[model samples]
Target chain A: MANTMLHINHIAKTFNPGTITEKKALLDVELTLNEGDFVTVIGGNGAGKSTMLNAVAGVFPVDSGKIEIGGVDVTHLPEYKRAKYLGRVFQDPMTGTAATMNIEENMALAMRRGQPRGLKWGIRPMEREMYREQLRTLGLGLEDRMQSKVGLLSGGQRQALTLLMATLKTPKLLLLDEHTAALDPKTAAKVLELTEKIVAEQKLTAMMVTHNMKDAIAIGNRLIMMNAGRIVVDVSGERKKNLTRAEVMGLFEKAAGEELDGDRLLLS
Target chain B: MEIIKLINALPGCVSQGVIWGIMAIGVYITYRILDVADLTVDGSIATGGAVATVLLMAGVNPWIALIVAFVVGMLTGLATGIFHTFMGIPAILAGILTQLSLYSVNLAILGKANLPLNATKLELLISQRNVRALSLDNPLIVLAIVTAGVIALLYLFFGTELGCSLRATGANNAMARAQGINTNTNKVLGLMLSNGLVALSGALLCQYQGFTDVGMGRGAIVIGLAAVIIGEVLFSKIFNNFALKLLAVSIGAVIYFVVIQVVLWLGLDTDFLKMLQALVVAVFLAIPYWKGKYFNKKTGKGA
Candidate 1:
């Protein structure tokens, strides 16, 4: 068996399809990730990078095609229903976690994601120790402040907490939609380091979308570049490790058959 | 002394307060927890009273009649929920639609504008006649126990997994859905729960007052909002626990009724009471908004 963890089959999506402002956001996109494969995605503005992530996350229905996670088809699943099989962290720090809830409570919710919630107490006494231990791994001294509301935390701390919540249950597929983009550079590096540690330790299959070319090149086992609703370039393993920004730009120009002039894709 | 007369009427005020307090708690669930200003209570309260009064007239047990009223109130919430979620109507408009439709429904249930439960013929749980009666028959004692029970049950329920998800849905729908909770379903469930409690309180009120009128619930949402706001303003600092917060709401309702009785005793025209209440609630509601806008200036100058 191929043991593919995520398979996006010829997916297509459009925004305001019948209007003058209609934009085809995704165009017959296909991708497959095997177990332990961490893929980084890069694209410029108006590209389909975030749309592809949204499509997989089921933020809205794709116009056509199917998606499968761990061999189970989820094309028709609503966002919440699909959440059972995937862990998603959004670009906005405020998007990923409930700010009004305490840290332990947020973790408890993630721990039971996809499980049928019943009348049982949301956070059992025994789960506290486990939550503390998990928070300790963040190295933010958050373990001691488990009862603090998440809203009191800084943007960086909230993003880190959101990352922990996403991975706490060991989801079959993890989707990162520029999860670190809202942080200071220092915090971004720290969050990315934590991301690497968790994914490596758990051997999680993940796809991360980023605007930073260097970060995209450096973070994952595989790299794919999207443009105008299609993946234009893909590289993996030894070839991906040695790739440089200039060469990647050259590859984009050659594949896209145009000068790489989008100001949104940060070469630095 | 005027104060002495107000003191003499305190027990009656407390009994009425106890009944309205339960209704206010129901409003709290939707207004505070579910974050929707559900107008269903205005109609559902009367629906509850109508059902209970009609059933009691038919010689049904008061306890069973209360449950039936609660179930009917839940149906009103269900209608509003379906209107909002399934039909894609805005939550406020959906509630208004339910409230409007429930006018005819309440009338149909009672077969008139009002129905009276004769205390001598009907077996009642609590009655205004016994409000001054210092015994187990007193409506105050029964209502107090019932309020305490409700507060205890609500405390336990909110601590549960399902309840937490419902709270999360109110707090943040985006996050709730991302965690695999169906926000629409939770919204509907919350409305149902809120309206159910409102109806139960209505049933109790009907029996206590010995009558159910179609117009009994007019301006009821304001009363519920007044109770909630007053409770938060006065007891929020002291009541940190969820259960204590609910208790504060009950206390708030008591204070509200006591204040009204004082106003009545003070010889203020009774016609102006509703306007006075509207102004009081409006001012209180404005305080937080004003604090955020003007008092908390970024320059840190004293207001």
Candidate 2:
């Protein structure tokens, strides 16, 4: 059995369809993730990593495609309708938290997503303890500062919090779109480490898009490179383990029929 | 001083203040909380007032009319929210379109450009006259009711799951979504609740003013923004709690009205009201940036 947590088949997305500005952001794309599969996606700007994740999340209608999670077809579902099956962390740290709300309050929101969120279960003591335990796992000393506004948290802390939020319900898949690129080097490393820890602990099938080739190779079980709206390379198993930055660059060049452009792939 | 005359007009100003202050709270919901500026409030306010007046004229109980006005306002808000989230309309543009459409809707409901309630025959405020014992114009009683209603609602809501999701949608729609919160639904609900309150304010306002003019909601969003800015600037430290946000906004409305009244008393022509409103908002809006840059240089805090 495939045991796939997610599958994207024959997906295509065209922006500004039929207009002068019409652009093909994603051309016929196909991918599948076995349960517990940790996949890293790499691409140049406009190469469709984000677009693929967006399609899976149903941000907008895919020009053409079928999306399935846990054997359920969701090609026609909207973003909100599909939310119960997926957790998404945006590229912007600021995009994942409410600034004025206290940390616990923010978490409470994340904890209650997709359910009929109501006043009856507004973070009881047990839930607070649960949140504290989750925060403690992050090892960011956030357990003690549950009342602090999330705005006060550093980018790394917020990203980590977002990671926890994404996995809170153990959805079939978690979509992380360069969730740590904006942070400082130290913070990025910490968040990435937390990302690894949570995915392993939860055994979640996840797709993370990263600009950092080193981290991509270092973190996930599989790595896919894309250029010109299609997957250029997909590596996994022992092959993925033996991959290096140079080999990945070579694959990109082969797929694009060109030399690797000036280094935009984050090297850390 | 001219300020005393402004103070004498305090009730009228505060009455207007609370009315728009509630609208400000509505604005704050969309603008500050939901990170949306649902201009539907401008129309929703008139909608509320129009509903209240029509129902009152139809011999509905005053309180029932108030509730109906709120429901009508919420429907208007829902329309805007649905357009923005489901239809993919930008928030600002969505609000503008809804506001424009509401003008026709309001006229349709009122059967004309406006509706007027005969204040004398209407049930006055409890403070102005005892319901059974006395007869006095009771705008203050209604003011207290609105103030109390807003505060209670805010307190009750911020603690709810749906409510928190709504707040998170404003703060971080992505986060809200990742956590299983449907931001679109929350945005729609938040806008509805916000404009609903604003509509209530409008309903009461029309009753208090004895008339509902088609143009009464002109620049309503600005007034609401002004009240919210002023309140946050003046009471940041005092009302940091979610429960206090509504009260602070109410006071902001009162303060805004008082300032306008004072200016009007000082021989400034009423024609300058709009200009003065802009200047006041501009000054207050600059405060945070000013404090962040200059004042904070020494004190280590933003304006």
Candidate 3:
């Protein structure tokens, strides 16, 4: 059965009104992710990739339109209310983990997502073992440093920790907003590989926004390219499989009717 | 050469320092741990004292009255967090709003410009005058009670599931949200706890000083911040561990008190203490950024 994991319909966002600086961040944008859909979103700067993620996450009230996850209408819900159904990671390494907390504690927080919190220590003996096994999957040897404060970890290590934490609850949809942008090139590649392995293993519906075109083509079952606050191109299956860096760039130029000048997008 | 003399002159230094220590613990939760500047401490201290004294006047038990003060403090803190998280107000403005409102609340509770608790309220812990023969003037006994209570509570609270989430929220709110921890709730909770503790200290101070003036909390946030920053810079240098920062903060409060005596003995105007506070805080706050930006590569590497 092809169950839909997420649906975005006719969403539009405009900043400021009756003022000189009104700018629209998203416009009549529509997107849908079937169960286990791994959609890679690629666009240049101001392409509304992050804004779209923020809108879906309810960072704030969007101007209009509907967002559904697991067939439930969640467009007007606050971020905290919708949190149980979605897991997220941001671009900055520092944004995703409490730097002062131990690695194990961070994992426990993610594991207990949406559960009633209390004054007791969050992680127990059984939970510790579960966290260790999960950390092992990263192959980053973080299990041995469970008690170590996460702030001490390198950028790559923190991002890897974030990925594990995000999927721990098996959220209905996972949002990764340039989750690897802060890492060095080599570490970013490694983390991306880990992202794929985990997405495949969990079979979780995922949306990832990235600037790198090769990663855009290589990582997911579907590719979505956005520009001027709209989904400019959508590719899947055989067409998506053969997507090249050059073809993605050509479509951006054709849809926007101008050569892209910003360094926000990588072109070959 | 005169450290011992400085300690002798500031008889209330230990007890006063401990009270400041509790407030520092609050400062720590919001500023150091949460990474948000909260200006509510100034109003909250007065709010705690006012609530406690008012409750005592209404015939509430001394201990129970103190708890009431803490509750008021929490509400004030919650208001501050709500401003930032829900109303989209800047964090500083959010704190300022709560702080301004707390001023009127304190005035109403006191029923006058100040509330005198020495005539009305019991000492925080009932001391047995003959049990150990330690006089009321003994600073060690005072420090002992306050320190033990604060350390135990902080250790217990920060170790809990909610506490870790609070710390994580301050450390990185986005990550806290990613993990399904509500940063808004945590922020509000953290402010409430921080101000709650600060006001509890204020209640203690009122009894210790004989009164809770409407302005007693003036410049208090600065004093607490100075103690906290001084503590972190000195302690992190030696302990080199995250968990030990609490202990370091306690020691820092003690050091700040001891230094106050030295400044007093040097004939520095008591009125100028606030200026001295600003200087000390400026130095320590810059220490970490300096150490990271300059000394880390030159001297060595460690956080």
Candidate 4:
């Protein structure tokens, strides 16, 4: 039995509808993922990749269509209401974790995501020990500095901590919106490696949006290409594993009937 | 002789400081923890004083009257919270709207400009008459206990799940929502808790002065901000603990009042007090911004 983990059906979203600045961000976008599937999404600027992720996250109500998570209809759910089933890491490290709070506190928050938060102690002694072990896995020496505020950390450290926070509760679907785009190349590679480790260990269903073409091909079991607010190409299984950067560009051009602009989809 | 006069005024300044210090703690919740400069306290404090005085005059228990005052104050916060969250108004404007409407509501509660809680007829929790008294009835002793109790309760509350959520909401709305925390409800809850303390402080202030005046809280927000800034400047390096931060706020209020006493004893005109207070707060508030813009710029990172 192949259970569907995420179902985004014929969804459409238009920003500032009926205005001068109107943008059809997503038009008839349909996507579905099975349990434990890791899909990589690649697109140009304004290609609607992030918008689709936001739609699934329920950042705003879609103009049309329905979405389901774990076979449960969530089209009308608000962002926070839908948060129980999803873990999200944003492109900007600042958007994923609370800076003023300490590392242990941030993890404690993620550990209880979707759970009823009440008058109980926010972090228990046992939970602290567990968090210490989890932080050690990052190999970033954060375990010893659990009490340090998240604001004091470098961008790479924050991104790693956010990745750990997102998967702490084992979300039904993990959305990574270019989670390492803001970091230096060295740090970016390190965080990417960590992301792979976490997803594999948890057997998590995931969607990763990236600008680097090599990353889209080299990682994830499936690859999706988007252009002009719709998916232009999708490949999975063994085909996705053997794909090269040049092949993806050729596929994009053939499917969209337009040259894949070098600036938008970098081969290198 | 002048030194003796200043020394004689010390006890009164300390007691009044403690009363306003509690109000400052309430301000600390919105200003420091929630990142909101809530002006609702100005009117809500008057509302608390009005409710307490009216109830005390009608033969209610002092403690019970204070509780009622606290509840009413929380209602004012709810109104502002709804305006800001549900109605999509800016936080500052929401607070201002509630503060404006509360003036009429408070007048209706009292039905006059002022109401007296005479010590001769009514048993008070704390009173100005006991400033020189050595008994437990001394306003200083009673207020200190209340301040300590309030700080302890707040410290515990902030360590709880719901409390951390509220803190997270203040720290970052986007992250809080991403974590499945409802930022709207948390903001409203924070507002309610803050105003409840503000009202409680107002109730104590009413009892201490033996009267509740509708205009008593006119500049209350300034006093609260003054206390918060003073506390931050004096104890930010030393008091990293939550409870100590609150205690710093209370002590800050005491220092504020003592300074005022010294200025008065030095023959400054009484009419210039409000302007003086506003000036002091403005300068202190600008210091951080100026430091970041001018002094810290050379450090090579803005963070």
Candidate 5:
């Protein structure tokens, strides 16, 4: 009886079709997330994991199928239009925030997402205190440097800021595409912890793509594995809660009919 | 080189620089804020002059003529924007295409290579004859007031939410789109605003010189860029405020003209002035790139 936050039905995508370097990135991929469900996605290289997330985010049009967020058909909506219903964090730290703008300006832009931007002042004086409060919660001491340009921030700090910006409006679905992959180990762990806390605090429906098998099994309430442009394994509830890395690998091997070949995935 | 002659010319040079400084502010919007090197200024400036001249000759009010020129100039930007965004042309090429097409548009508007406004018969806002005047009729005084007005208006506009979106669109396109900004529309809006200001400068320049020549704006983009680079090189560190930065660009234009005047007085041939201007701009533009490439030590590992 739960509301469905996202419904991606039979989507397929082909990059550079009919060319010498054609790539079938996604094929007949179907996914649905109930309200408050957190799903973690895992796959080897060339699997449709990130593609699925991008598909849902409307980065590109699907070759086939319909996408709906909050029961609104969004199949033909452009990425910016679809952004009204989704919060997304990219793997690259530079992809989420405007580097030249100050910290408060970036947050101000995010806070007005999906709303009509007019000739009124971009950042009101009252909003500065709110931004300071939010930055304080990050515990990175960014609260004291609200006027500092984002380009001066380290990669981890930018990613953390991007995470904060993404969740500021409590989006119906949060898409994290290897958002912590580029950070150092300690920072990655810290960001991951923050991600879990924010998602729980907001009780947001979310999908996360990760290469680390441990994180894939450990974080979310549901797990979906993709390979060869299709979902190869899906486990949830009690089964996913008790799932181990070895057991997930066994399941991937059984479904894929081959050994997991991503060394980075296995090593991580 | 008579010192008295040079002193007499200095005021005129300053007046000319301030007039062109308005055009350079237009250039700053595209080149600095929107991060586009729009070549459409060359054609659009001339278009403004031609439109204003033709309108003035028809006995229309000069102020109304300037406004009409500004609106027409915005149309030129619209053409380039459509070419770049809707038609999928690259930004630089789109500007070039618009510039080329505007050559014919300018000719059609003027009906000749030159159009003159008789300042004696017409009540013009500014003129070169009053360049040395110390009274209210002095072109320098009027131009300074106009330039200050332009900077104040732009400062206010850029602080608005819509303006912030435009700035974000230029700073990081991907991030802007992800934040629900329609970047294409913002880009078009930026282009229109820039070319409108450029055209307004053109109208003022035509009224000041009392004539509009088809070739008056030939190297306009270069001059605008020279002013922008000179301004940033000289004042970027101290002029952190938005209005002050615009003032810097205007002052930069004045410096450019004063330097040219000095070079002219130092026995430089008038025939070689264009080449000298080009060289000055090239060197100024290269300084930052060279500093980044040759002076700075590599600090971080390559990704």
Candidate 6:
């Protein structure tokens, strides 16, 4: 039996509770991922896709549910403490890496994730060879410019570096929140390919949130559709592999009781 | 107008600048590395002097007095850190509050507004009386060795795993947290380290000048900033290494004092020196913003 890597039980989150601007971002969301389960999450604007991911990452406290990663209860743990169990990539490239630091330094930071940072040197001489090998896999020529500041890189390069950094330690779970959404079409496709390659090579359990509908159907072994604040459609195995865009939309409309209203979703 | 008079004052100005260079380095940690405009230095510098002077008067070893001043300075930073991080106050306001309260604290330590250190009777670490001397007692020689030691230690610290996390915390708070670094803890640690150095500088300054005054550190933030900006503007391109960057800051302090001396020699009133320092810093600080706004080449609109 596959071990459960992530267990999010009946979690709910509300932003600015009791205020006029209060928005219910997540409502009774529940999810469980087995080891090596690559799940793709899709939703319209204001849906709870990102909120659910953030809850799992411990970005904010859930109002009334427990989150466990690798069988460890972490519902009340702060973001930094919970970071030990997960790797995260944000939508904006700039949000994932320190611009002022060099590529090797950024990777060195990620390499030490979940470990106590002591008085030891940040990057050992031997570690530089490892970083160089990893950068070579990205094929962006970053290995030659290890000393170059990350601020000098383009958006796609930064996103690729972020992906490498996120999975550098083989995280128990990876959370990608529309990481390629900010890149141009060609760059986005490249990053998506890299993400798929890395996920499979590491045999890592991962959750990816994407705005592209085709990517949702094409990339992961399982597909989950969310509407409002709940999961509406879930399909995996042979059923998920054969899922078409129109059928997914039909399932969403039937479960949600409304036609999808997101123009960006439709156009993409 | 006399060239010989101006030449005679150069050594004194260099010694004062070197001492303040240590304080400016403290500013660089908070301002440049930690990305905080910590105003706590304004009061903590005097707090260092007060603590050191009092200890020296009690027949304590000068080095031990300096160490105590450094520790007290770190305590002041811890107070500001608690206010900013634990209590959720804005960093600037937290610094200001600590600085304001430190005034009373400094006065209490000295038990008066000013305390004089009779250098002839007490064995001092560094004194202006020997600034021009070629012997080991010369303030410049001692200051040079001290400043180099500081730069070497800081370079090593910043290379450590803990130090990199502090730099990441300043460079990008969001990214730092994602990498499992406790950013609040790092911020507090950085503030403490910065203020400890500032207080050490204050101790040295008091001993060198033979007195500690409550108002001696007035406008210190401006002078520190001037030194930092001057250093960056002059040596940023060439001094990319961490140790060299710190060295540039010390050199920048020397240049700042040299400029002030030149102005004074040009018959400028000593009272206007503060105004002059403020203006110079303000102008240097604004140059980057103005260049980014006005000097960029116009790129065509995106497709």
Candidate 4 Cα outliers beyond 4 Å, as residue runs: B300-303
Show the lowest summed lDDT stretch of 10 residues, model 4 chain A. Answer: A259-268
**CAPRI classification of candidate 6:** high
Supply candidate 6's per-residue lDDT for B303. Answer: 22
Evaluated at residue B11, the lDDT of candidate 1 is 90
The C-alpha TM-scores of every prediction are 0.96, 0.89, 0.89, 0.98, 0.97, 0.98
> Which residue pairs does candidate 6 place in steric collision?
none
Model 2: TM-score for chain B? 0.90
- Best-matching candidate per DockQ: 6
lDDT of 1: 0.91
**Per-residue lDDT tens digits of candidate 5, residues A1-268?**
8999999899999999999999999988888889999999998888988989888888899999999999999999999898888898999999999999999999999998888899999999999999899999999999999989999999999999999999998799999999999999999999999999999999999999998888888998999999889998999999999999888888989998997765835436
Docking class of 4: high
Question: Candidate 2 residues B66-134, lDDT tens each?
Answer: 889889999999999888988999988989999999999999888898666775676533221221222
TM-score, predicted candidate 1 vs. hidden true structure: 0.96
Residue-wise C-alpha lDDT for candidate 1, range B1-303, written one tens digit per residue: 467888889999999988999999999999999999999899999999999999999999888998899899999999999999999999999999999999999999999998999998999999998877878999988798889988999999989999999988998888899899999999999999999989999999999999999889888888999999999999998888889888888888889999898888989899998898888889989999998887568557753
Instruction: Please write out the lDDT profile of model 4 over residues B1-303, one tens digit for every residue.
Output: 389999999999999999999999999999999999999999999999999998988989998998899899899999999999999999999999999999899899999988888988997888898898988778887787889999999999999999999999999888898899999999999999999999999999999999998888888999999999999999999999999999999999999999999999999899999999999999999999998888667776655
Poorest stretch of ten by lDDT in candidate 6 chain B: B294-303
Per-candidate local distance difference test: 0.91, 0.82, 0.81, 0.93, 0.91, 0.93
Kindly indicate the candidate among 1 and 4 with the higher TM-score.
Answer: 4
DockQ of 1: 0.80
Sum up the clashes in candidate 4. Answer: 0
- lDDT per residue (tens digit) for residues A22-90 in model 1: 999998799999989999999888789999998998889999999999999999999999999889888
Q: Residue B4 of model 6: what lDDT?
A: 96
Candidate 2 Cα outliers beyond 4 Å, as residue runs: A17-22, A245-268, B1-7, B86-89, B111-116, B126-138, B289-303
How many clashes does the backbone of model 6 have? 0
Per-residue accuracy of model 3 over A1-268 as CA lDDT, tens digit each: 6999999988999878557998899988998889998999988788899999999988878988999999999998878778889988889988888887889988888887877679988677899999999998889999899999999999999999988988998989999999887788999999999999989999999999987788889989999989889999899888999988778778778987888765766532
**Off by more than 4 A, model 5:** A262-267, B295-303
> What tens-digit string does per-residue lDDT give for candidate 2 at A170-258?
78898999998999999998988888888899988999999888889988899998887899899999999999888988888888898
